[model samples]
Target: MQLEKDSKLELNDRSRQIGDVITDVESKVRKKYETHFQEQEDKIAELQRQLNLVSARSRRPKRGRKGKEV
Candidate 1:
């Protein structure tokens, strides 16, 4: 009976350790994904800004039929 109790305790301890490891791994993975998403969002925002600047610079004033400013 004593040996059986000891075995059970050891198994419980190992299970707890595994659970802790899983939790830690999950936390790390979530942090990594969050960082990657934030980087992608920053890149997209920068590209949008650049596109707006380019489009704004490409606009031209309209002219009349004689080529004079309307």
Candidate 2:
């Protein structure tokens, strides 16, 4: 009976260790993905700013027509 109890305790300890490792790995992965997403967002914002600047510079001006004499 004592041997059975010791075996059960050992199994529980190993299970807890595995669970802790899994949690740590998950946290690291989440942080990495968040950083990657932010970088992509920043790049997109820069590209949009450049596009707006180019568009504004390329606009043509309209000329007023001369009025006809009555």
Candidate 3:
């Protein structure tokens, strides 16, 4: 009976260790993905800004077109 109890304790300890390792790996992966997503978001924002600049320029009438009658 004592040997069985000892084996059970060892098994429980190993399980706890594995669980801790899994949790740590999960945390690292989540952080990495968050960083990746943030970088992508920043790139998208930059592209949007550039698009807005181009759009603003395109919407204005050119000086040459003003002298011509519609």
Candidate 4:
């Protein structure tokens, strides 16, 4: 009976350690993905800003010399 109890305790300890390691690895992966997503968001925002500038320029008239008298 005592031997069985000792075996159970050892198994529980090993299971707990395995769970802790898996949790740690999961946390790191989650953080890496979060950073990757943030970088993508920043890139998308920059592209949007550039697109707006191009559109604004296209909507404006040419400055100097279509030659219809000053």
Q: Find the candidate with the highest TM-score and give its number.
A: 4
Give model 2's TM-score versus the native structure.
0.68
Candidate 4 lDDT for residue 51: 100
Model 2, stretches more than 4 Å misplaced?
1-9, 60-70
lDDT of 1 by residue, 10-67 (tens): 7777677678778888999999999999999999999999999988877866679999
lDDT, candidate 4, 10-64, per-residue tens: 7777677678778888999999999999999999999999999999998876665
| Arranged by TM-score, best first | 4, 3, 1, 2
RMSD (CA, Å), each prediction: 7.7, 9.4, 7.5, 7.4
Which lDDT tens digits does candidate 2 get at residues 1-70?
0123345567777677678778888999999999999999999999999999988876744445665432
The candidate scoring highest on lDDT is 1
Better of 2 and 4 by TM-score: 4
TM-scores of the models, in the given order? 0.70, 0.68, 0.76, 0.76
Name the runs in model 3 displaced over 4 angstroms: 1-9, 64-70
- Give candidate 4 misplaced runs (Cα > 4 Å): 1-9, 65-70
lDDT of 4: 0.80
Error of 4 at 66 (Å): 9.4
**If both were scored by lDDT, which would come out higher, candidate 1 or candidate 4?**
1
Evaluate residue 20 in candidate 1 and report its C-alpha lDDT on the 0 to 100 scale: 77
